[model samples]
Target: MRWSAGWHGSAGSDRRPAGGRTVPGLREVWTCGWPEARVRAVGDGPVALAVIGECGADDAQLRDALPVVRAEGWRALTRWPGSYLVIARSGETLAVIGDLAGQHPVYYRTDAAGTWWSTAASALAALDGAPVDVTALAAHLAFGQPDVLAERSLFRDVQRVPGGHLLLVGPGGVAVEPYEPAAYAPVGLREQAPVVRAALAEAVAARIDDRPVSADLAGLDSTTLACLAAQRGPVAAVTFADERLRDDDLAFAARTAATVPGLAHHPVPGAPGTVYYAGLDDLPGLPLTDAPNAYVVTASIKRAVLDTVAGNTPGPGVHFTGAAGDAVLSAPSSYLADLLRERRHRRAWQHALGHARLRHTSSFAVLSRARPASRVDLAGAWWQTAAELRRPVRDWIPQAQRPLAWTPLLASADWMTPDVRGLLADAVDEAAGALSDAPARLSDWSDRQDLARVGANTSGWRALALAGHGIELAAPFLDNEVIRACLAVPADERGAPGQYKPLLDAAFTGTGVLPGFVLARSTKGGFNALAYAGLRDNAPVLRELLGPSSHLAALGLVTEQPVADALARAAAGQPTAQGALHLVVAAEVWLRQLAAAPATWWEEVSGRVAAA
Candidate 1:
């Protein structure tokens, strides 16, 4: 719920005119939920800079970055370790820089008076009471990709600045400028491992300070973080163990805790209520996230873990999650397409065989799918996907088995109505027409898009943790430096089969930080059983939520009868539209909460209101 907003014009000018002489100055911006200590400002009056969030920069660095950013643009201020937002004012020009990841997104709206910007799109939308943009929401639900319509926010008239970009507002006008490239120059995994290790260590170190640090020890990424944090001091490592899950995560967690010193293992046993969709009955209690967050469906389990950490730590604490580890550390099998594009046929076949073995399919099937992707550029792929969306819905296929594309349409795309599908297809076509500077390789573009998706959702999870438990959630894997270090390595090697998170293994092995057992572990646990159980138990509530009166259905996005049928199939333990339903339900919940949201994000001063 933390946000900050400012403007480059005199819409809300605080200065009174002396003798009918209007002062030409920028209005004072407003903020909420930001502590004074976390807020850092340098310079004064017209030319100044301010940073809000968990920034690792001091006054010296801020003073250094201000002039550099003015001369070099927004990229100069992005070298810091932690995630943060930078607002710089150089004379009449102002720049707002968001992180490489969408964890800290920037949204703005421009008009005759001036341009207004904020960290929260909803806040900007509230200035004009903008309604939901159906096409954007349709694209979000159907594609599940972040950059499809990168500039469109969920609320109409509130424009979003894409990740790795900055919003520059000056006397001339407002413009969105890219500060970073979609992909970095290729580096071998071996050469990049040490750099990644250093970046990750710094990212983790940035979060560790006076606060009590706790981490999730359920998988390799979180385990690495827990071990790293343990080096600093004691860390409360939590593993949510539910008998219904029947996973080996708890066993591995216990072994790691026993071996790794300074890690006090606290296993939180899951109750029947600790399942996905467990808390949907009380919609008002949920935090109003700025976008549709998948974590809303599984907040019960997250809350359970947070409650355990809260019980152990007496005061405010920092929780580390391995949110974007898979996105950054490992590439998808889509890297096989990148291999085929490079004419590395032998390597492509070998990797395809490995992936086929993992999926229990023929290698030819994997190669055939990747071959088509190799032949098509990003725009062509989007065009083909738009054509498919315009046609009838296809049968449900597991997302992992889908063919590699620029943006693979998920099973959720099948859940929308025909009209909505057409709208989404048109939007996709428009986005394809606008795709001029896409990354040359599929893996490069897809990797950044994947990171953006995970980063955005993790921001929602951070908000949930903060609002519900007074805790700060940190994801070191999504830091700008860590992303640059890891993604610079070629995707094929980073996602090379036969090794799990090869980048992490190479970085931490022989370093004596993460244990050999953890680095060697290949199998990761699944929460399918818990998800199904939650769906079965909460059928009535879901039926009511996605029924005819649902907000999503009211918007003509989801068909009411089909959603009800899907819920019935889910409750009966059949192959159903669980993923799609989660998106629909989450969007529905978000819409409901948005209607009830208060306009407390801004405060009116001296009867002068800032127009959004």
Candidate 2:
């Protein structure tokens, strides 16, 4: 990688620079000591392309991926997983894009002369000419982080490329287009499930080769992949040790790997990392805008784990992950359905009920022992009371005057379907012709879409951490062909054989590398208990970071005393709604980071204005 402009590039090889200093028009490129072939790029004309981080996938795997990049040129291809950014020079134009899902945060800005560029957005504000967006600060105070909406960034002009999107900066102006999730006709469940399984097996085998590979070693996804690969070659599996945050995963990984013949299992310490939870770029004594929590700390923790794993071993091997498999293959509609069905939790249900004013009576109340009349009151909280309590004035004119909005996210699938499908009756059928476009209920369609994206998104985040170590991580389940085939499968077959990722499991069922129980296990490990415990253990930091801020109290929607009392109760082992709220507070720390950044940085990034 080349460093152009005024950017100074340094990593472990260079001494640390003093804090709070700023650089202007500097470009630096750093990569972990992965093979040079691992970071190859090709483009001509006005292109300045960089393919850094962990993208090499063995010779055969490279053969599969290279054709896509070569054919599409610099456009974002759908199948690439892990933490990555592709900056391409097409003709006289420049475009930098991240993977379909945000595995890592990408920050960029157009210069004063309007030439666009991207760098790690995390600390870009520390650079010269970056602007700050205070309204993003307010939104961060309200929503915890700023990327909840598409094209909005903490710094005004710096924007995030939405998942399944490409950002093109050309003389014609900036154009963002969705990649990976091409529209395809839906197919029947039985036929599609097997196809997904076959495509994924092929993708995994192509990348892993005959060498040993690594798996995260948990339930469903990783275990299944390890088993499949074992049929073709020896494999290694790793998991976090029995620490506060990784206790359940350690046991699950060990147990699963035990069944894989000739597979080695490595359990490394997985502790909460210690870093700038709110902003890694913040200088000492400069307050952060959001809470810095254990997850950020995980970055360092992951690096240490991988380093130890590599030192114990000899050469590099493909690392397999279940990443984003949930988003790409599983249904999130269950959570939404649970809210609608469990009529007793009105406040909780408000968060899941479809947009206010569209509530409908369903059989869920009868299914859950709550009466229909009681459920009606639950609707009031989500529909009328909650909105009025949160804000009297609508943020904008009511939806009645707005273009009907549509997103393919399926909140709940258990209940409500045909009713919801009516909302998107006029949507384009891109996923048609090749597959069965059966007029399924809207709920089923939503569930399918969620499953398709979650796996890629989740794996992408893990891949980001691996990138720091320069390890190429791949998720066979995230292969576009696998996803497209899964899309062809019927809903029942999608979750068949009593397994959540049945198609994925079935793809490896004959491999004989995984234990029968590992493949058949239905229960998922719950990580929330440990995470909440950690939060309670660190209550002092939480209070110090959030208590002084009047952002929540000023809204008047929530009483300050109750919020404070709840935190106290949680710290004393009494977990409540307040504990979950703290997660939001932790995210707020990052928002504050963006809000307080230099104004010039914000202006060069997201193209927004703010209050002083």
Candidate 3:
């Protein structure tokens, strides 16, 4: 019975199917067997709200805004990394809201009985909604698809409220509208750092309330958060390392921990985070997530976090690490492009040189990339749709928060043999169109790309869900306030290749949370060596996972044999695209899950839920 709930009249209990029924006050009867949810009732009036996850502005923060909600008739409490639900009741009206970045997703539908909503997709879909969304499944499996695909959900009948939007579920039925991400007016460069420092500190401070906590120190987000956490009191800091990977994650953590007086840095010996095949055969829930690497790392990462927290830190501690630091902080290569657009040549060139130096690449490469229409890549064009500036697309982008490119992510379609690719011939095109339709800027496509990062939905909510069970984990960098602050600073100030996220560097160094040397240090570690070896070790599992009747191929989204050949080549020591391969492995695993789901709970629900 691992869950978090605060209900009066003892309506609070485990989420297991065997638990008690009805919360007395809630509109819909919740019937499911998931323990990873938090339900808390707050405020006294006809208006009420209850969230099912540990993400939201702190209780006091929400309480302070009550006056405003009453005056305005509606309010969404928090924005950054806050997956919150604000349900307001006035007369027969019910307003349900989700966070700005889809972290705490809210979905709902209306019928003769009024409207119902929740964070869990299937929970609501089971009650009433459309059948499986195959195109969404294909788009999801398409690597590099926009991480946050507007309001579309796995169930066509179940629509989600956008991150910056609100859903009014009332006697009048459902109506959706946008609210947050209020226009950001950039400040002068001199004012940037101080604002960043204040916002970063506030975000970090909000998460450090009294619970014993552990922080990460490998990258800028982790190091800064951990350092700031230390300023308040003693906190355990951690990073992972092993001989196989060149990334000196542990060494970096150790050095920084030594500099900060109250910080305790623990170097956790690395385990094979998991080869693409780690869960090759696993398919957990129905209408599985569209998030990238979700099947690949979600459970393993959760296991690692829980294990680390349980093993060393005393009495259930919350784990905090950098999650959306790159997306939130790194300006797209487009900032320089925007400068070029404005004809600010001198400043653009200066930033370009600095960025080129950071990547250890050429200024030409930076210039070419920065210019949105610089290259017309034919191989991967998801759409011929010109961006807002009518520039051409960027080419193949292999990993997290990359600016939108023309091609489907490399591994997005690679898993299927040619036959399967043809079967789902429009897969890549549909995916590209879907992503392109979302409003984005050339200067911050990567920021929009945050929707798909591994840290976005699955990982954060998993941790939030676990919070109810006394295993609290936090990523202060993902705080809404931190996101707002970063948005205020010009993207160019921090988006250069070598100087990516300089604001973070300057924030800590300026505040003395980290040394000047740390701020000046350019390179961060990479772990390709470890990933390759892990992939090799897990070859057998992968081979079995991709046998003749793969669900992906059966669904006409992938062909089986090419994947088999790829596994063999990877095993034979040929050049491997590790990033793309991970997507293939994970997507296949999800297809397996979707295939297997019907036999279990989904089978019962899928049949009843009709198509749109």
Give me the candidate number with maximum TM-score.
1
- Where is model 1 poorest over a 10-residue stretch in terms of lDDT? 15-24
Regions more than 4 Å wrong, model 1 = 10-27, 44-46, 608-612
> Tens digits of per-residue lDDT for model 1 on 1-612?
777777667565432211121112324555567766677778745567777788888789887775675564667688788898888778878888888888889999988877778888988777767889998998888877778899999999999998778998887899998889877988999988999999988888988999999999999989989999999999999999998888889999999999999999999999989988999999777888889888999999999999999988868799999989999999888988888988999999999889989989999999988888999989998899889988998877667667778788877677788888888889889988997678889998888888888898898899899999999999999989999999999888999888888999999999999889999999898889988998999999998888877888888788776777788888889977677888888999998887765545544547666433
User: Measured by TM-score, how close is model 3 to the native structure?
Assistant: 0.79
lDDT (10s digit) by residue, model 2, range 483-522: 5666555433453323466655555465554576766666
Which of 2 and 3 is ahead in TM-score?
Answer: 3
Q: lDDT of all the models against the reference?
A: 0.85, 0.44, 0.55
TM-score of each: 0.95, 0.61, 0.79
Question: Which candidate, 1 or 2, has the higher lDDT?
Answer: 1
lDDT digits (tens) for residues 35-58 of candidate 3:
333454555565454554445455
RMSD of 3: 6.2
Evaluation by lDDT, superior candidate among 2 and 3:
3
Pick out the ten consecutive residues of candidate 3 with the lowest summed lDDT: 1-10
